[model samples]
Target chain A: MRLRLRPRDDSYYEMFTDSANNLVIAARLLVELMSDGADREAITEKMRACEHAGDDATHAIMRRLNKGSAPPINREDIYQLASNLDDVMDSMEAAVDLIGLYGLERLPKGIIDQIEVLERAAELTAEAMPRLRHLDDLTRYWIEINQLENQADRIYRKLLARLFSGEYDALTVLKLKDVIEELENAADAFEHVANTVETIVVKNG
Target chain B: MRLRLRPRDDSYYEMFTDSANNLVIAARLLVELMSDGADREAITEKMRACEHAGDDATHAIMRRLNKGSAPPINREDIYQLASNLDDVMDSMEAAVDLIGLYGLERLPKGIIDQIEVLERAAELTAEAMPRLRHLDDLTRYWIEINQLENQADRIYRKLLARLFSGEYDALTVLKLKDVIEELENAADAFEHVANTVETIVVKNG
Candidate 1:
């Protein structure tokens, strides 16, 4: 068997780690934004900053991937991973921004459950990024992310049922659904990142 | 410059074309579903089948990309293109399914504008996929798609403002927003697919 040489610059991995770290911050901010008596404007501004940071990190990775001859992992895997990570940040930012834009004073019931799932998923993703080099223990990261996504899904559906139950005004339901769906999208994006990592691992291993 | 050998199986391009064609049918169905006195169940069922066909096409392209030694385009581009195309289908399917699930009889105003944009975008995508091999005349395809997506975005924002204007009941706003947002997503997905194609063209040209 021919031996494959490792990539010269490991900066892509570092960039990924940076992006994943930003996601954790964004997810946490999302949780904070949902809490009572929170400053919606301040939290959303912070989340927007986090998203911008995530975008820069993703751009850095893409720049290196393009300038360099070969990536440490498959080039496509790097792109997909970076894009998905950015997507998670974007979704979080959108949710937070929607809450602020709608001027929602109160969050609907079941949102806390979704936020919990998001926080755990974000934390697990940050933990998994560093292990991309070896990828041996990364299976559990993705498996767990998949489970968290399912948990988020259940909570999302429950929240939807509540929204349509006539408890909230139509305008309120509209605002809350936008926020909840974005959170669900973030959860799904996290799963996409995990799945990308798994694909990279299988190819490399 | 070294000459690169083209891929042996061109089925991937054909598969993309098939998927894009399905989007056209779905878009047409969406327009049909929005018309008065329409059979919502039958139309949504048809769109769901189109989505499944799109999925199958995407899977076929991916299977070939994985199994084959090389693709006609960059492997990552191929994967992104396939995945984004599938995403457009998913978003369209979600919008249609929501209408059925919500049992919404009357759609909010400005929906028809969104559908028109989607229909044009879908047609343009169907026109663009086959040109992946030549990488010629694709710039306009992506550019037009971007414009169409912007159009869809404008319509979406207008619809949102209308939804929150107290014109509809709270439950009605909830249901209509879901449907409109999915259409907006489909428009975004089409732009993504177009952008991927443009990137592939730049790389391979």
Candidate 2:
């Protein structure tokens, strides 16, 4: 009888990539929501679905981790990466949901800048997730995510200054700041995901 | 010749307890800051120092983790617990700093409620940290912290409803919400720390 070891399952990487893709989808939807005359309800509903899908992907990864002998990378790294990606999705969903809950009809100028940073960060994250398998070419991914987070931080501070400058009514300033802060958090979450991946690479290398 | 294995260093548990004690001190200071006729500058300055001490404790734990062969628990669990404890301190410090930066003379009513829950949670956390060595009597600690977080979430939602009810002007609502959200995040961080402990207990049991 021929004996064969089970092939090392690599599906965790695929699931991580899927979650990253969901973040990209959510980020794009957010950008579209800020556009003129966009269908807010439909776009946000789709974003919600994307966030749900990300959660499902994370669950799948966890289930696999529980059953599998060991993952290619450290198990905790996988868990942290999954959780941080889920956080990015959660922050994006919260920002969109608050927009709807607060009945915000107009987009603030600073929001567009914030969304642009989120979109780029999400794109970079999606691009980086697959590299976990080989741990190659990841330095630029994390570095650029860090730079994007710094940019988002600057935009966030400037947005707050503008909000409090009395250019807009108090209510308007409050609502816009809520949304902007979530976007900033989403950017931070992206940086956190990148940091986790960097840690995994360093440990595994 | 006699062979002896290096004794397992258990100082990480002590450092964790120290960090949790720092959280309790910060939380108490936060409660004091919300009191009438409180010295905002001095109280927040002291809170800043508490946060710095928590950072130092966390750094010590990390330094030990890096050099030590192994911990009683999983290395990643140790890292997660320490990091989450540090995050609780960070959120509290951020809330206090923002309160100072906004230069608000008076706090909203809900802040006191939030601070009380934080104080209780911090106390519970301090009580729980030492149990990390034995993994005994941890279930009640985490369960109570989870309940406290739920209580905090209820208060937070009610607080938001009040903020938007037009009792206060838009700017005050803006400032208060920023502080309130950080408090909520602190509560969430506490829950996260508890959850990490629960995971460790389950794994080690």
Candidate 3:
């Protein structure tokens, strides 16, 4: 091997990948929440466990950053990246929590559209985290997430209109809206994660 | 002034103060929304105008940061401060917009409690911005805002319990909850702003 100058701290990359992968699992849990006759209580419990896993991943990254073990990127970027990933999981968990709390049964068909967008975004994010080492390919990730966010917004508005269409009673609307809104927030949180990555690339790459 | 070597970009302080001051105005407008026979439409229109003004203030700061002006603090802190302040305004504006969209006739009594907390937080924030120059006195500001946020949370959950207490019909509950949730978000955003300020003081001061 050629003579190396500095030992690169690649653990940060691995930690971030673990965090993003946790989001993917959480997104799939959300998908299961949309399934017909699915055990939502069990799924919500699983989602809670998934969120805990995400918190552990986030805490691991933070502990490493605090150690100041020759950070691969700026401390703040790593903090923001960890926090944003954590935020996505939190939003997803909140959605499940509300679904159970409000006794939300028979979710609208439009909800599938919202959940699908989240699943796609989560998958894309998982794919993009490994590529963080090479920033050039991230432009595509950023563009696609932006587009996915837009799509999620549109689906959200449509759901809003449908809820207000007088088909469902107000209380039912409130419960469903709470669930859908959390998913939308999850999507937005994904975009925030992408933005942090872009910031990292622009500043360091 | 006698031995000044580095010219300080105190304009950042001024811009931040302006933004916080704008939130004060917006919060007061929210108070007016709670008034008996209040011209809510006119108030919402004014709130929209206030949000636009906030946007302008945020853009001015961003433009200044972009021009390579000597930021007294780290550039990221400035960016976060501006964005968090902007988020406060956006959430306030959204509350008003949804109130109008849902044609909320009369709000619950607990809403006044929420508005009062926001107004107080906004005032405290406006007072704190100038003291940013001397990061030492900021402890009171941070402590008070955190207390206020905790207060806001208690008020929110109480209101949620009240909403679900079989008092109002489901439709009204939906409308009021949307408005209340946005206000809660504004309070959380204010805390985010304080966190950024603390970060600045920790790193730079």
Candidate 4:
């Protein structure tokens, strides 16, 4: 791949790299939104920014897809890849958006714990993205991503067991569970991306 | 695309379609497993098969990726697409696996309701995958998929509120909530595929 190009001629790697960078920022925003218990309006505004930035990155990939030449891979596949990556941010923002929209102040211990795990997973994902620029190095971070995903799974399981064994009301059990699941799903998406990156290494390398 | 290939060559799509078809069956099995407490071991075995099938499909896509050839779309993008679709099955199977592994023979009404919604979502997804073979018809199912996703979201919200409102024991609440969240995540993945397909249509049309 040539380094010099017109503004619109950036390589596919650049598009995905930008998307990955946005994911890191979104992850950080999520931590701030939850841990700090920001005001509803403020959090919502931040989430909107996150969603917009993520969506813009997705569109950049789509533009590459629709550029009317052979993409590096299948167009539909690229579209899905871009969209799903954006979705990790979309889903996370939605969770935070709801937390604010629902006026959920004083986050629960279960949720806070899940977020901590999620933040760690996001950090791993951010680290993994930079490696994707060099496919050879992808394997290095791939295992770490998987480990983060496994850790997330364990946390999710423990949280559920605690929810069931404790004395909370039925509705509260449901709410906490939703919040935790969304966080887990966001982490799961990161794992999916990791899996995608791993496949790239196995195939392209 | 020319349909000029051996059964072995088409096996990827065949197996892919088969895995999706199994989604509906697995979901129905989930419903029955919930009702027929007598066949726990058998149902567990079947659920494992579903998980394995999903893994196989993921591997098949990776195999295609490793061949150093482009899929119908970009190679990297297709890898991500395949991984994301397989994940729906993986996640759903995990829920069923967990229920049985944890000996959750009897679940609360709310949890069951969420599972029912999940079964419907899976059915819709099963309906959607075959349409992929016909590129032109992909967008037709988007509305139905979006509707099911939205419905699942509503049920998730209502169920969680009930969980937290003090209807069940804390521990039980925890378990049931986890189950519900996994089911919801399964639905979320389907919605994602639908969104991807919709984008394909809008761009291609």
Model 2 segments beyond 4 Å from truth?
A1-10, A39-49, A59-68, A143-166, B1-71, B74-131, B134-158, B198-205
**DockQ numbers for every candidate?**
0.19, 0.16, 0.15, 0.16
Candidate with best TM-score = 3
Model 2 C-alpha lDDT per residue in residues A82-129, reported as the tens digit of each score? 889988998999898878767778766888999999999999998988
Clashing pairs in 2: none
Across A1-205, the per-residue lDDT of candidate 3 in tens digits comes to: 1111111246777778878877888888888888888998889888888887888888878777877787778888989999999999999999999988988778889988998999999999989988886665887898899799979976886787678778898667767888888999999999899878866865665
Q: Is the docking of candidate 1 incorrect, acceptable, medium or high quality?
A: incorrect
lDDT by residue (B1-205, candidate 2, tens digit) is 1111121245778878888888888898899998888988988888877877887788878888899767878888889998999999999999999998998787778889999999999999999888888877887897799789879976886788678777888778878888999999999999899878866764555
Q: How far is candidate 3 from the true structure (C-alpha RMSD, Å)?
A: 7.9
User: Total backbone clashes of model 2?
Assistant: 0
lDDT of 1 by residue, B39-113 (tens): 888887787778777777777787797787677667877888889999999999999999889888778758999
lDDT of 4: 0.66
Model 1 reproduces a share of the real contacts of: 0.20
Greater-TM-score candidate between 2 and 4: 2
The local distance difference test score of each candidate is: 0.80, 0.84, 0.84, 0.66
TM-score of chain A of 3: 0.93
TM-score of each candidate? 0.67, 0.67, 0.68, 0.57
Candidate 3: tens digits of C-alpha lDDT, residues B14-107: 8888888889999999999898899988898889888878877876786677566677887777878988998999899888878777667778
